[model samples]
Every structure is written in C-alpha cells, then in structure tokens.
Target: MIHVVFEKANVEALRKSFELDPSMDGEIAEVQDDFAVGPLADVDTEEGAAARLQWWKDILAGGHNEGLADDGHVDDQKVVRELKAKLDENPEEIVWIWAAQNKHDVSGYYWLMSQLTEYQGRIYILYLNNLPFINEKGNIFYPTNLFQIQPKEFVKAKKLARVITPSEFEVDPDEWTKLCNEDKGVRQLEGGKKLVSRGYDYYDNELLKFVTKEWQKGNKLLQQYFSKSKEITGDSYLLWRLKYLVEVGKIEMQGDWRNMKDFQVRLPGTNAEAAETTSAEASQS
Candidate 1:
C-alpha cells in the first residue's frame, strides 16, 4: 500500500502516529498552488510544467512578494513523475489517497486522478471531509482531514477506504481540464461529480475585521489569530492579504515583514522622522 496525502501537515501527522507497514510507502502530492485562476494542464510533459511555474511566478510577484516568496513555486513535474514511477514499478500495489473537502485537498485529488488515466494499479480514496468522528473526549467532530482525527480513528477510516471505479476516473479527466481552466477560486466540485473552480472569498473581509480589532490592543503573530479563527483554511493566503494591506498603507509594521513572529500591526499616522527627533528626550531605558 502507498498512501498519497494532499497536505504536508496531514502527511507529517500520519507519519508520526500511524506507522506504514513494511511493504507500504507514503507520498505527498500537494501542489500548494491551487489558488491559481487560469487554465492548467496535467503535469505530464515539460510544456505543462513550464506553464504552471510561470503562472506561479506571475501571481506571487504581483504585489504578494512580501508574504509568499517572490519566486516560490511548486514543482508539479517532480510530484507527478515520482507517483508515476511508483505506480509503474508495482502495478498491483494499492494507491490510497487521503483528501478532504477543502480547496487544496479536493484540487490535488482531481489532479492525481487525471494523471492516473492509464494506470493499472488499484486506487482507493478516503474522503473524510464530511464524516463524523469521536475524539478522545467522546465528542463528535467533523474533521477536515486525517490530521485532526485521533490515531485510533484512522484505523477505522483505513478499513472504510473505497476503491475508485473505472467510470469515476474516466469522467474526471475532462472535468479536471475544465476545472484547471476556470477563472475562479477552487472550492467544491459541482454536484459532487464534476470539478469546478469558481472562486470565493467569503472570509477575507471578516478576517480583516477581526485582525484590525485585535491590532488595536497590542502586538500579535499570525499564528495567534489563526489558531483562534475557524474561518480560513490557508494561513499563507491570510498573510498575503495582510501584506497587501501594508503595501496599500492600510497597515504598518515595525519589524521584518517576512517573519510572522515579528509582526506588530499599527495604523499609519506617526512619522518615523518625528520619532527619531524625539528619541533624545524619551526615557533612556
């Protein structure tokens, strides 16, 4: 068995808790660039790879350079190549994909299925986005991914994995292409059978309001507010929006902008020149 997970955090969590059998392997296929809003093709050729990389570069460099790296890009070719090699090497090995309902995992799932059009190996999916599970305290919670479920609950999910039918894979290739080309945010696939990427930002305005309220009190880190909010999925996206706010003069920072730990938010008003001039008159300590 080879478990393919959609997020790096889920992979790490599973590795720490659930040990793979001696004959099993683990792979991560998270593109980390699904927020794109253009046509994208399956990364089976050099041309497709180049196109995806260029898209990533253009989007990241356009005013979002402070949060996400100016050149931060996902190597889709490497991930696809590795998965193909593994499937070809062991045609009988089962490929178990663990994905959630969110944009990241859902997009990755569709992309992987598109790549495995001619694969002979068996493929299974553990889509636990809407399933309910009990935690250690006996309270039921609907987890987004395997990372949130208890270790013992993972065993149950493994037992419930469903094999991907030939029809499902066949229908997904065209859907995948359509989804990649859509100029919207990737969220849920329409009708649970077709994939679509009509974008939505229902949480950004609320997140900005929450952060502004918190900033009025004192300094804060990205993690501090992220841990408290359940409205957003990707932390990087929120940070990117914050950096944009800073660039537009809606917010100001006193420390290194790249490091979230050093983030100290304030409204732009006081001039640095005035503060420098008054330094001698302030307390020395």
Candidate 2:
C-alpha cells in the first residue's frame, strides 16, 4: 500500500504511526502546495500551470517564506506522475489518501483524487471529518489537520478508509474542473467536500481588524492574527496582502518593509515618534 498525505508534517506523523504498527507500513508521499488559496485557472493545462507558478512568484517576491522555492507545484506534478507510474507497474498496489477536516486537506484531496480516477477502486480515502480522536493527553477532540492526530490514533483512523466509489470518481473530478474554470483566488470548505469560491481579498477585512492605530511589528501582528482569527491562511500570502494594503494607503508602514520583523504597521495618521517611545518603554519594562 502507498499512502498519500497533503502536509509535510503529516508525512512524519505517518512514519511514526508506521513504526507503532508495522503491518500498516507503506511508502508515504506528500502533495505539496496549499490549493486552498491562489489562482486555479485551467490549472490542468500547461499555460494555466505556468500562470499559477508566476502568481506564486509574485507573492513570494514580497520576501515572505524565503526558504520555499517557486517550483513546488511543478515538483508536486512530478510526484503525482511517479505515483501513477508506480501504480501502473504493480496493479496489486493500492493507494490510501489521508485527509483531515480543513480546506487545505479537502482542497488537496479534490485536486489529487481527480487525477487518480483512472485508478478508481485502487484508491482509498481516510477522511477524518468531524471524527473524534484521543490526543496525547487522552482528551477526545476533533482535528482539522492530519498532523494534529496522535500516531496511535491513526491506527484507529485506518478503519475509516473506504474505497473511492464510482460515483465519487465521476462527480469529484467534475467538481475540480468547475473550480478550475471558476478561476477564483480562494476555495473555502463549506462542508463535506463542498467548496465555496471567494475573491483574493477574502481575508483582507479580517487582517485589517488586527491593525490598530498604534504601531505593531509585522511579525507580531501576524502572530496575533493567526492566534485570534478563525480563518487561517498562509503567512506569506497574508504578508503579501499586507504589503498591498500598504501600497493602497490602507495601512502605514515604517522601517525595512521587506522583512516582517524589520517593519511595523499601523492605521493612517498615527504618531510614529510616540509609538516608538511606547515600544521602547514596553521593552524596557
């Protein structure tokens, strides 16, 4: 059996689970790239793929996530091609796709399973949607991502695996195609494999709520937003949007704007000197 997961952290979690139960051991492959956010116009076509890559390039050009390369989606395509080849080489080999309840995992599920329709019966899914699992502390809780589950809990999760039905194989791909054609910047999980499309600035107002009249460091502001906001997105994308907010004069920026830690942001017409003095006093205290 070959296991496919969406997040990189999930790859390690599965490895740990394999160690706990040797019988469930299999090769694990991660589908990189968060399809929850970004342009998905004709993503299956070569021109659309190039356009998507360029979009990522523009987002990363803002100097967020310096470690990530621009060719991740391209690499992911290669990974999928290799997975298909492996399946072709061995008909007995079955695939297991693990996903948890969240737009990131669900969107990735739609993108990946659409490509594996040819392998219909051989592909299985373990969707832990709204399912209760015991964490490290033995508390029962619902998880939003696969990485959040304890390795031991995965042994139980394996029971949730079900073969991709013929109906789903036919319907899910159409859903993906519809999403691609819609060309929306954001795909939100409404519930149970249903996605709602939204514009690129979907999170802009939420981001703005975090911005105050008093200057706040970019990194600190992002931390507060991630901790407080119910809607979560990539920090790189949020940073890019923050810069856009600055460009349009919705927010004021100071210091080196290229790096999050090196810059500070506030609402328009804020007292810069007083803000700096307050920051210095807080640091001294």
Q: Deviation in angstroms for 237 in model 2?
A: 0.7
Clashes of 1: 2
Task: Write down the lDDT of every candidate, Cα atoms only.
Answer: 0.61, 0.88
Candidate 2: what lDDT?
A: 0.88
lDDT of 1 by residue, 167-262 (tens): 878776666677655635435544344455544454456555555422332225455566777555555455556666778777665555455555
Candidate 2's TM-score: 0.92
Please report, as a residue range, the 10-residue window in candidate 2 with the lowest summed lDDT.
65-74
Off by over 4 Å in 1: 16-48, 54-74, 185-203, 213-230, 252-254, 267-285
Scored against the true structure, residue 211 in model 1 reaches a CA lDDT of 50
Q: Per-residue lDDT tens digits of candidate 2, residues 1-285?
A: 999999889999888998888988999998888899998988877888778777888887857565365545446788789899999999899999999889999989999999888998999999988999998888999998888988899988999999999999999999998988887799899878899899999999999999999989999999999999999899888988988999999999888757888999999867876789899999999
Total clashing pairs in model 2:
0
